[model samples]
Target: MPFTPFHMGAGLAAKAAIDRHFSVLTFGIAQIAMDIEPLIGMIRDADVLHGPTHTYIGALAIGFAVILVSPFICRPILRRYNYEARAMRASWLACPEHLSKGAVALGAFIGTLSHVLLDSLMHADVRPFWPVSNSNPLLGLVSVDAVYQLCFWLGAASAIAWLVGKYRHGRENG
Candidate 1:
């Protein structure tokens, strides 16, 4: 549970404006995305890989993967802003602001990796140091029970709400 919201919220915060509703939503989704496999397998299989989302390599790969796809996601919204690219690369653009493709890729990588780190701390048996060597520390710090779940949900909700309110306020004022 901790990993689900934390990872996703980090994703949202990284991709969108820091205080945007969509960022929170995206974070929540990313955090919970891997849970479904385990939940379903718990009833059917005794031993499952818990899916790739739990792995550090998997998280980084997924994050950058999402960023690579972001151009498609931004295309429609960007159209109104008259967004243009200096090159044909989807990852690079020559827009109103001065930015680099590396920045976007880095943001996507960090956003996703944050989720893996947060989740590994809470969930036991997670192989964070995977591929590089599945060596990890037994940092048994937190539990993923009702209270913790509620807190994570609340944090996500609050961040999302704040972002929405800010967006609305900005629209009204602008």
Candidate 2:
């Protein structure tokens, strides 16, 4: 994935489908963390754009790091979003000011792990197994266009599901 935003489609869908268990905020942070290596490489013109950070082991380490640091980041953002939601009269759009440790861990792992898997499909240098195996058996399995389309449709589905869920919840409350 060229951008973390593309990965966010999955996070949005997961958050929608499993509202209690998934934290899209934490997921987004993990996605950004996964991409940091590539971004830096691209900036510095490094020979290997996808280095060890694109590997499963590295991603897991990053996931744990993100999990540890997410609370400090998630808190203020959640508070601001919830505040804006209240002012806009869209309380349903508001989220808890604090994400449970479980949600943060779940989102971090899902985000980082899935990022590596997805990148493996498109980038030849993406060695998910890394130290265990340098060969990317998953590369070229799908076209880059297909991956983009998948993300786009997932985002569309997430939006539709959210709207429908909101409507249903409003009716139930009424």
Sliding window of 10 residues with minimal summed lDDT for model 1: 90-99
Candidate 2: 10-residue stretch with minimal lDDT? 165-174
Top candidate on TM-score is: 2
lDDT of 1 by residue, 51-160 (tens): 56668777776765665565454445445443443234322222223224555555555655665676666666577777676655734555556435645565576657
| Residue 22 alpha-carbon offset, candidate 1, angstroms | 9.9
The TM-score between candidate 2 and the true structure equals 0.94
TM-score of 1: 0.52
**Top of the candidates by lDDT:** 2
| TM, every model | 0.52, 0.94
Cα lDDT of model 2 overall? Answer: 0.86
* Cα error of candidate 1 at position 151, Å: 5.3
Question: CA lDDT of 136 in candidate 1?
Answer: 52
